[model samples]
Target: MRHITSALLLSGSLLSGSALAECQNTGNFQQWLNSFKHQATASGIPANLVNNALHNIQYDPSVIELDRSQNTVSQTFLQYAANKANSYRLTNGQRKMREDRPLFQRIERQFGVPAPVLTAYWALESDFGNVTGNVQTLRALATLAYDCRRGSFFHNELMHALRLIQRGDIKVPEMMGAWAGELGQLQFIPSSYNKHAVDYDGDGRRDLIHSRADALASAASLLRQYGWQSRQPWLVEVKVPVQMNWALARLGKKLPVAQWAKQGVTDVSGRPLRTSGNAALLLPMGRNGPAFLAYPNFDVMLRWNKSTVYSTSAAYLASRYAGAGQVRYGNAPIQVLSVAQVKQLQSKLRARGLRVTKIDGIIGEETRRAVRLVQQQMRLPADGYPDLTFFQKL
Candidate 1:
C-alpha cells in the first residue's frame, strides 16, 4: 500500500450515480461478478483461473462497514507516535535485525535502505508479522471493487491480485491479508506486490506472506524505488528557537542545514545543526511539541505512508533502533482538537475565504496548510497545527 494510513482513511462518499450504477451492487452481486470474470478472462487471465479464484465470492458488507468507520483525526502526534513506536516494537525490531544480520547486510548493500527502517516498518505494519490480518484477500478485494466509494481503485487492485495468483506467487486459497487487500508482512497492496516484490531467498516466488527474507528485501526494494538515499539521514530530532517565525516550519519549505542553523535551529543538545543536504523543520504537533529536521529521505517515508504522524513515528522508531534516545517533549503540552472541533474550525476557515476542500473533520495536509495561512494572517505562530485556542480564535 503506497499510503497505508490514507488507504485506511478512504472517503465513505459514494461515486456519482452513473458510476455507482456501473459497479456498485448489493443484490446484483452475481451479475457484477460474472461481468468482472468475463473482463478478467478477456484481459488474458486464464478463464479457469479466474473462475477458481473468484468462486463462491459473495459481497462482504463488513468490509464496507470497516472502511467507513476509520478515522485518524482524533489522534495527537504524541499519542499516535507512542502507539506506533513503543518500546515493544523497538525491542523486537532490534532483535529481528540481529537475527537476520547477513540478509539485512545484503539488502542494505543492494538497496541502500537501512535494516532498522525496514524493521520499524515491519514492526508497525504487522507486529513483526504476528498479525497480518485474517481477512480473505479475494473476498475483500471483490467486495471493495463492487463498492462505489473507491470502486475503480480497488477494481484495479483486484485485477493485479488476480495476476499475482496467475504468476504462481501465491495460491488463491492462501491469499489472506488486510481488509484493504494488502498482503504479506509489510502489508503491500496487490499492485506493489506485483511491482517491487523480490525473491531474495531465490525461492522461485516472491512470497512476502511467509518469507522474512522476501518481505524485508521487498520492503527495502520498494523504499529504494521511492528514492531512498544510501547513508543519508531521514530525520533528526532538533530544537527550534522560540522567537523564530513558525511559518517556516513546514514540509514543503526545505532550506540548507546551514541556513537553518543560521536561523537558530540546532540539534537536540543545542549544538549546531550539521548536515550536508536541505532539511525541513517539521513541527508535527506545532511549535509547542517535539520537533525534527526532516531530510529528503523523510519525504520517501511520507510516500510510503502519507500521514505525518505515521511517517514520523516510523522514522523515529528507526532512529531508536539505531541507538537514538527518547524524544524530548516541548515546554508546554499540546492541545489536541476533537473531530467536531476540527469540523467547526474548517467551517470557520471557509467563512474567512480560506481554501479547505472538505469539512471532513480530518487534520489532513490541506487543513494544516489553511490553518497555517490563518495563523499567519492573525500574527500568531504559523505552525499549521489546530488546537482549541486556534479554533476559538477562528
Candidate 2:
C-alpha cells in the first residue's frame, strides 16, 4: 500500500542565516534542497531529471501552512457528507457516468469495483477534474521533506516523484498538483500513482493527468487491490435498538448483519435488514445520532483515506450515485470541534490522566474514547463525540 504526507517552504522569519543554521544544525531550506541533489543522484535517479525538476525549486511556506491548517476543518458526519455529496456533485457525477458509461462498465467488469465508487473518488479528489491545485509537485515535496516535521515520509515521496520524471511517466511541467504532491484527476500522491496507475487506454502511458480512462481505471484498480467486492454495499444506515451494547458503536469491529439484526438493528425504515456479509457498526456522531453498518468496501475506502469522515463521505456519495437519498440525521443536532478546540480538549484529557500523547489537533480514536470516559465521569451520554457543551465544562 502507498502512503501520503504533506510539507512547506521558506518564510521571511526563517530566512535569517542564524535561524537557518539552527535548523537541525545542517542548514537552511535552500541549502537542504541543494544537498538533496547528491542524495537523489546517489539513489540512481538521473542527475538531469533531478536538476530539471528541483534545480530552481523554491521552498513553499504556504504548503506548510496548509498542511497544519488542514486538520482544523472539523465537521459532523452529516455536515461533511452534505458538503461533499451536494446536488451539484451528484448531478455532475451522474452526468459523467452517463457520458462515460462504456468506460465505467469496462472498468467495473475488469476490476470488480462498481462505477459509482470510483466516480465518487473522482469527484471528491479533484472536483471531477475541474480544480486540481497549481503548486509545483517537486517543490512542495522538497519543502515538506526539508521541514523535518514529517521529513522522512515526504522525502520518500519526493524521491518517487523524481523517479516518475526520470522514467518519463510524467513530464516536469505537468507534475503540478496538490500541495502534497498528489497528481492527476484522482489526486493520488506520487508514490500511490507510481504503484497503482495503469495504462488502461493502451496509449503506452499511464497518464492519470489527461486520461480519464487511466485515472478512473487506476482508482478502481486500487480498490480491487485492497480486496473490494463487486456490487456490495459499502454502508447502510439503520435504526439501532436503544438497549444494544454501546461499545459495539466503534467502527471496524466486524459482526454479522444477522447478528446485529437479532439485536433489533433494522434498515433506515426500521424494517429487518438482510445482508449475507459481515459489517461493522459505526456511530460517527454518537449512539443518539445516525447509525450505519459499514461493510468491507467501506474499509477499502478507509485505506484510500484514513479519515472516517472522508471514507463515509465517499461511501455516501457512491450510494447517491445509485439513486439513494440524503442521510437522515435524527436525534440531537450535530456538534463539531475545531482543531484548536480539540487540542484544548486533548490537553484537558491529558491532565485527567488519559493517554493523549500527540496533540496534533485531530480528534482520532484516542481522543474520542477519552471523550467517552469524560462523559461517563460527568454522567453524560458517553457517546464518545465532543461538542460545545462538553468542552465548555472543561
For lDDT, the strongest prediction is 1
Give one digit per residue, the lDDT tens place, for model 2 in 258-366. 9888878898888899676899888887776778899988888877776677778888899889877778785556676787898789899999999776575666667
- TM-scores of the candidates in the order shown: 0.93, 0.87
Query: Which candidate has the highest TM-score of all?
Result: 1
Weakest ten-residue segment in model 1 by summed lDDT: 9-18
What does candidate 1's lDDT look like per residue over 1-394, in tens digits?
2224332322223222223223345557788889999999999999999999999999998988776654443566787778777778877889999999999999999999998899988988888988787899999999988887787888888999999999999998789988888788988888889999999999899999999999999999988988999999999999888778788889999988888888788888998877768989998888888999999999999888766777888899999998888898975778888878888998888888888867766687778999999888888888999877888888
Model 1 TM-score (2 dp) = 0.93
